[model samples]
Target chain A: MSITAPQGFVAAGVTAGLKPSGRADVALVRNLGPSMSAAAVFTSNRVFAAPVKWSRQAVADGQLQAVILNSGGANACTGPEGFADSAATASRVADRLGLITDNVAVCSTGLIGVRLPMDLLLAGVDDAAASLAPDGGPDAARAIMTTDTVPKEAVAEGAGWSIGGMAKGAGMLAPGLATMLVVLTTDAELPADALQGALREATRLSFDRADSDGCMSTNDTVILMSSGASGVTPGVAEFTASLTALCQDLARHLIADAEGAAHEIAIEVTGAASERDAELVGREIARSNLFKCAIFGGDPNWGRVLSAIGVTDAAFDADDLDVSFNGVMVCRAGQIGEPRDLVDLSGRHVRVTVDLHAGDRSATILTNDLTYDYVKENAEYST
Target chain B: MSITAPQGFVAAGVTAGLKPSGRADVALVRNLGPSMSAAAVFTSNRVFAAPVKWSRQAVADGQLQAVILNSGGANACTGPEGFADSAATASRVADRLGLITDNVAVCSTGLIGVRLPMDLLLAGVDDAAASLAPDGGPDAARAIMTTDTVPKEAVAEGAGWSIGGMAKGAGMLAPGLATMLVVLTTDAELPADALQGALREATRLSFDRADSDGCMSTNDTVILMSSGASGVTPGVAEFTASLTALCQDLARHLIADAEGAAHEIAIEVTGAASERDAELVGREIARSNLFKCAIFGGDPNWGRVLSAIGVTDAAFDADDLDVSFNGVMVCRAGQIGEPRDLVDLSGRHVRVTVDLHAGDRSATILTNDLTYDYVKENAEYST
Candidate 1:
């Protein structure tokens, strides 16, 4: 049911008093392993948080033993002091675990440019390390949440291994991984190179394709660790598939929890010249304000859909394209295929499919409809 | 005054019943040309309206005598029949004026799909021609408006000639000249190539940089015509400067009238490696929903600005970037420069300045804040 369901991993979550609501704001997970190999992917945004800078550098070693995460302060855009605070937090965790500081990773999320509550975070790290348990995954999941309606965690069992993860993101989400911050753990025996390769591929189709608001975050990151405690050593292909599924499930959960979203929309682009082209078209539609607003209003405005794709450089003539909304053929061969009154959109789930007529390559992107609440929530968020 | 406030032109606006409200929905303007040279621009969107296709081809002849415009039903995506309607409308206008059909351009805006009410449009075209007057600019301005709160018209008087224009756009606005439809008329004599060159140069910095909602339209266009009826041939250099100022003025009006917008935000990006880089950075910040929402709520959340720019490919280290919101230094060298409580955004205008520290190039983009009404208006727009 939780990320710690995997073997050889102990985790704990605790309150650091950083959040005014007294919610859990600090989490720790350690790999009690015969071997510790890990890989990580970070936000492509040139502007990065202090913690992200540290974690990215540490992962260059291709191995990690533990990760320390905190919420309520992103420790981003806080200058030299922010980097020192992140390093100090990681050092405190490593010191408590009697491990080398270089073997630990750090991640922080929440409001950007606010100083980390050093006194509270340092104490919370100690508490989390002492309380670490095999069944502490749920608590860890709860600690890394900010404006999320619910805790997102998923586990998938395989023939001999299992994949599990926890994620926290609701806004500032778009391509280049959005504001996603995820941690995945598995008991499979895999090298760091293999894990990195699998993560890049899986994320490209999962988190990288989930564009909720089209705002990339400076703190987006995903780290994967293998404890090698299960001794399963499954084939790389099977492990990769399980990892991909886990990521997809977590992505779905993230989309469902998108801030102020009323409906989860899936935009599918088929018959593109390449998978990249299909993804480009699909993402363009997903990020379109007009398309999203129409979805929110429960209007099957297929003209807006086709118009969104029309601006892209994809090799498809307008007349050669076919668009369907929720199984209704709203447009065919670039012409209005159905009356606007014919399509019913009062439901929660909406599916839009676009056929490019170029090649067999296709892609699907998960997004949320732009709603009144989305504007209200985000507009009032900083205030 | 209106687009024909310039000396050598006459215009008219008439009710055609194209809109159920029985408002003026048809307009006509003619260049009383002793020298009939013109320049025009069309939407870059591949899924263009039928009128756009016709106008592009008609303008290819390097000479234009008149333009006919209608609102309430954009003849877009109606297939071959839509093309026929566009031709028919142009033909009707040519017949009334006794000019070649190829010399008369056409433009249509409003809801997509539904065919034009040919009976109403044809009759209204005749009325517009009959009622054409040198001072009928205001009527023509009113006829070409759809969902616009008011008619947009401006006039600039020079030494011996004048420049006047009208525009209509309230939403679906973004980089590729937004969803705006503009008609500019000048009395000074100039060749079509010079007009075309000036139009392109002015639009590059004016219309192309007005990003209110980041939704490019299928019917965006701007047409510039010279009557040469004044016989006052200003130097090309002076004429181009006047035209550029006119475009900037109109672009500002368009941004001011963006749908449901409560505030106009100006984003300036400086010290980029190239003008393109600066524009890219400025556009990224301008189109950020989170940043726009923050400004809407009067919250000076500066981190959103930095993160938005960081996602671009511009060459600037995060640590070397600085951001200011509404004259308050919120970020310095990619770090928090001022307390959130210190920045005040309780005004109808917001200004954001970003310094990349990479080079000397700079650019500015005008946008409007994302508000609840914006969502409401766009969601129910078509329905």
Candidate 2:
């Protein structure tokens, strides 16, 4: 019970013969309610998949009756024909559901610069929309995976309404956004604008803070749909907080399942002049290959952390910085303080704290280490 | 003969008990000159080593009598005491050579936030100064290494004089200026300003373009010394070209010796609006961990190349980009073209060509594939 965990929503996952494994490769979620509204965020990359182009326009109407997703080919860099394929896909989904094309959103994930298996894909849309069920969210989540080993799903209950979501991604997951595909559903009474506001605030602190591989994807998209079935009109702050907490949970799920990652690092940056400084410092350290490699080796190399932050424009004095790995203060006041060997890293969860010693704002960035298996998985991804 | 391949430089490498391996960890280079003109560059990282701070000031007068470099400790983030250690080391070298402390530059590399073994270091300075010889460049080259497997040395000759140089750096080689220490000796009758201009242009094309691991070090320092012993007033063009070629040779050496690297990747971004665009695009691809990992697996994942450039502000239409892995042209006009398997990465050399088709300028960036040994070395480095 993923997306179906919420009321007034039905979903289905079906085999499209698009993937070489012939696994379930198509997913659909439909709104069945008195009110239909949605908001979405797509990849910031200028080069995106065909469905991203189509869905971006479809969501502009502030309401969506259905969302159709396929995982096999990215349909990115495929010229004008790719966009035509996506539009045809939305039209086909609309034909089966008896709705206009603008009320349908579309997304795709997989290899870039290749055309989708359109024949099998269009047929799967009809098969999927026909089989929509309230309990099909987990299957829908599984259908959208490329390299992910498991499906990701979460839920957050509000006063009388609830939010449920499912996501699929494992690589190219730096989230400017990642090649991530996500759909969240709620039965709360909210307009598209309100949903959009909540979604932006939630993602900014959740998915946006994850810097898994420092590589932004071309097919990232996250959607939020509301049906107003429960008729609970929660305040903006109340709704946004719950959504943010839910997204943070999903973000942790993403990192825990990240490809080739042996350790999940929580880099919390504290004492910054502004929130941006803290986030920038955290991202700078998270993206350092040397630091990641050191973590993979289970060595507490605080110098790599300091060197990583030294390149950023964050407000911090070099002499006033402090670093702690695990629970040991290996570096304090900018100098070696404790024996690095005293800090153990045998556990999968590692926390590194970088104290800017400047102000009060802080931020956390989630990432994984640079490992041999990560190299192997990605090297053989397309092969 | 490395730096001493020129006419008026003496050098030596001696063990100082700074390294546990008992290897030579101290290096000294002296300019026995008719004219004592010199120019140098330091790391752009604000959080730099004490030696970088001392050397930046020592070379401000455009003259340096000698340069003392040590391995095994960076002496960074060690507070006022670290600066004192650098100053003391410089003063001791000045006493041995009978030069002002202000004219003696010092450099240190290795673990950051730790102080150098000052007692052992000062004694090694005396030993190095006593053994300085006209043909001691190779020993000096070997002494400055931290994790490097081999010494990097290069020489290029002008009409009547020659320029010779040595460098040491492997990890953290993305220079905010080349994150390495270098010493160049030339016997031409050139002014300090002339040498500075030549060094900048040469390094901008050479070491500055090699972004190994995309990590910037705090101890990067490059010093150029001119004895003017040959009295050769070569034209600026002749000297600049020779210097650029020699620096390029050293840059290749650095990439080849990069830690945990198996294949060397030359990312050439062509048809850009400006040289800066070309460089930015090249670096965007070269710094990609996914792309580097893909290269290590001998898989031609040209999609990773396209995605890397998509995140940059370089001038390029997504539809017109073309990518080739070693000449197979896997992507043409932004769509799938030749089969990815047609590209062979069986050798140690791999070249990726991305044609923006946006303009006339182009640039090449040198990097290495991410490998297991790289992760192993960095993980165990501090231990």
Model 1 agreement with the true structure over A187-285: per-residue lDDT tens digits? 989999999999998898799989999998989999999998889888888888888988989999999999999998899999999998899899989
Residue pairs in clash, model 2: A175-A178, B260-B374
lDDT of 2 by residue, A1-383 (tens): 97999899999999999999989999999988777899999889877778888999999978998899999988887879999999999999999999889889999988887788788999999899888999989889999988888899999999899999999888888956655989999999899999999999998898989988899888899999998889889998999999999988888889989999999999999999999999999999999988998899898888888888899999999888889999788888888888987999889999999899999999999999988888888777761
Considering the true interface contacts (CA pairs under 8 Å between chains A and B), give the fraction that model 1 also has. 0.82
Off by over 4 Å in 1: none
Residues B84-108, candidate 2: write the lDDT tens digits. Answer: 9999999999999998899999999
- C-alpha DockQ of every model: 0.84, 0.78
Evaluated at residue B176, the lDDT of candidate 2 is 63
- Per-residue CA lDDT of model 1 for B51-150, tens digit only, reads 9999999999778888999998888888899988989998999999898999999999988767888988999899999999999889999998887888
Cα displacement (angstroms), candidate 1, residue A308, comes to 1.2
